[model samples]
Target: MPGPDLKRILARATSDDDVALSETYVWDLASLFSYSPSASQAFALSFTRRFGRTKSWRVAVKCLHLLHRLLRTLPSDHPFHSHLLRSHANAIISLNPCHFRCTSDELTIFVRSYALFLDEALFCLQVTKDPSLPPPETFAKKVEEVDQAVELVSQLQGLLDRAMDCRPLATAGRSSIVRSAMKHIIRDSFMWYATLWPRLMLVLDNLFQMPHRLCIAGLDIYTSAAEQAGRLEEYYDWCKRMSLCGPYEYPLVEKIPQIQVRAMESLVENMWQLTDSSSSSSPVTFSSSPSTLTVSESGSSNCVETLKNAAINVEWEKFEEEEKPLIQFGQECADWEDLLEASVDCSWTWAPLIFDEPKERSQNNGDNGLRKHEANLQEYNPFLDHAHPHAM
Candidate 1:
């Protein structure tokens, strides 16, 4: 139920000629910007207000189908052009106020078409990739790619901004539909960012200071939208789910601070274990300690390495597999679970002996006390206070 422009665009597009097809494609793409649920409701209201439901409802439904078909053809660089097609498709959802009569068949077609568009867009933005794309040629090339990726992301952000700024065409009863469309537009935009930013980080070699900025921008968009839309709980939950999977393996150590290193380490480790459980039947757990610890033998002192090596060396398939459980766990934990649950699972069989003791006590007791303390927190707390103020 768009204005005359949309109808004209569609009419010209569906004509039996190449010009119509190409025009249809571009028109469809442009129409994406206007096709929010809210906007549709507004359009429907405008139509109904001027021409009564009986006269205008069928035309509105027809417009929806034409828009859907047009959205089905957006191109992408990947083999699965369907991926790109979906992004625009999701934008064409119907808003509340029942644009036309609510027969089950019509509603089913509307929902199916809208859902298909969303799925296609989500897949294209998050899943479709050409393995054959040339790797970054040099550090500079990597940086440039990162910059380009950032620019593309910014363009996307601008589109959302415009969508939010537009006035809905309907003035009265269809407000909810207009709002729903706006929400859909914003949500899809954020989802696109979530899917693409991480991949861009992987492709870029040396981002210099870009990753930090990108992360901050992403976090800002997520936080702001969640807060404004009263979706903070859902947003946090989604973030937790996404982080558990550990999206990309850019050399983040150089970009993030040391204090944040442990947090990132836990996330990375959890992600790794989650992704590659077969590598070690026992889950990989992280300890809340620096890399080195102390030990004792024959009344002599020794140093032991407690930190696992901090490099990611996993295959992409394994990473993807592990990410699912973590994402699911995050969703489950988001509303009720403590934030720490999202951290690395630090429960290891041997960690108490190696890293959970005072250096002096470790030298004398051979880490026996540390092991005993882990089994009982009341004992561990008292022992830790007396033996390892530095460790605390």
Candidate 2:
């Protein structure tokens, strides 16, 4: 039921030809959505029908790009988002079984997985639409809210995984449309996956505070995050494989440090054991002496008796069996320093995170103002050399 202009745009947008979806066309659709309520609804219906019958991966991917842009560019209260959500909820444009009648197995895999990614994007829209769902920053406050946030984050991670699976074959990777789609996938992956990784870590951190809640059913949280972080690394690798990295342009996107996750796992494991030990402790206490030590004694003699009782309770057999004391201050200091360095290096920060020195130069040198300011500061401080003994 689309008007002639709307049909023409949709036809061009979802053509079988190997062309990238036009941003202008997408914006045109957005402009039409804003034209009037009836116009938006009509375009939604027409696009849904066209998208449902999509038989080509090119057409399918283009359609997803259009829908993705619409969902992304439009306001949260836009009727189009609600319309698509209602359509999917009613099974009008379901993507569960993407039967894109493609002949190539690679194309089939790409289409099906990309279809699932789009489905998750819709779910993300639905989550955002609901005012009741807690924001990620505060979602860890309650068990129920944490569950909701975890479910949402998990779905976003699945979307990232599916996007990874939608990688193009060598031949297809050269296609303009395929490359364009991969670029969009890169943006979405960075925006959703990168953002969600930190949020998941925050959830784990907050949950860790309540040992009772964590011990009850939260063990999987750590393993799941570690696994998802691995997938995220794979995604970064995929980006590199796609040649998305460039010196002035496509710097490798930052990711959560794996060391942070390992450190968290270590803490969680120790906490789990501590909680278990506390819960399973017995009521009986070890007695210091058989007869010499009594509950009550004079002040001076009490201290002597306490020392005597402590000496009596000592496992003299174990001490006699060992050749030296069990304390090693040197190794302990080394371990402490290692832990401190890791914490300082990888503590979660909202600003741009760069781990490698090569990229660190880019971050530092990219800002002309910062470089000039540093130069000025060095001029003011004569002993500003890093290797100088008097350097601060």
Candidate 3:
């Protein structure tokens, strides 16, 4: 059983009241985890049970927030992280069954979105530390590093989107808990924004070193990041409207550098020019003293033109229009003697010894009378199959 303090704090933290979680409770929970090994186990069991029993989105969001705070405040080497990792591995704290409900549809949507963001946060805390790109060295190595950075940046952008989706709509009330959660999300968004810029620049710097196809792909990645960056102001304004940001101003969104765009465009143009020049040049002729082989450009062009201009009608067979043959199985009747001859007995040789005989019980014996009553009750009531026979 969990200690009284643990139970009280958990109840208060996950209550339906519209209030922000107290910082004191967070520290208290951390202390409980550090206090004893059994405390952590108790917390896990009680937490899992409470989360499993809740249907309201508010309670679910509060529970996630509480868990998130603990994971953030705890030290890296704390036993709590290891315990959580094991619980997650064993599916003791699963998010698969999280279905939060609310009277307001908009609030429900926001809760679900916030829940998803918290889910990602917990995964990052437990599974992976910060994964950075390797230092750029060789051409192949540099390109590979840039590719990895590009993928990470893309993932960060997606996480940002998920965080941004945790918004209380205009129709919804600005609950303190919601604002509190948004404050954390806003800070996280800023950190991601800061990380995003460097990765985007890294991709841009190495864009030209990639192969022609990868060069285009890298450019596309940069464009996507730029577009997402452009939406930072909208997100900030949303936070301001929700009153989540008080006295603090969000950083200005950076404009995409024109020079980088021009460089990409110029590289693409040069590649296309080289391709056109090669294609327009005279056809090569190969020769040997014994025999000479030559390719005629005009003849090849004419052949291509003929193939493009020629039209041949094709008719396809419609299998759906034809009737498929139905399979018919022959039903052969066999006599009992024949079946018995072919059948091998799979029953145990001592089956008759284990089988119980239906014997009459005397009412004079208490145990026999109880057994007879149970047999009669079970026979008449099919629903009692799962009920304890002795309960009656």
Q: Clashing residue pairs, candidate 2?
A: none
Candidate 1 ranges beyond 4 A from true positions? 1-58, 74-131, 151-215, 218-392
Per-candidate clash tally: 9, 0, 0
lDDT of each: 0.38, 0.63, 0.64
- How do the residues 319-359 of candidate 2 rate in per-residue lDDT, one tens digit apiece? 45553433446655556667666656653324787676577
Of 2 and 3, the candidate ahead on lDDT is 3
Scanning candidate 3 in windows of ten residues, the lowest lDDT window is 309-318
Q: Candidate 1 residues 148-234, lDDT tens each?
A: 555554444444344333323323113333233333444544555455445434422222123344433433433333333333234
Q: Quote model 3's TM-score.
A: 0.59
Q: Between prediction 1 and prediction 3, which has the larger TM-score?
A: 3
TM-score of each: 0.27, 0.59, 0.59
Please give the lDDT score for candidate 2: 0.63
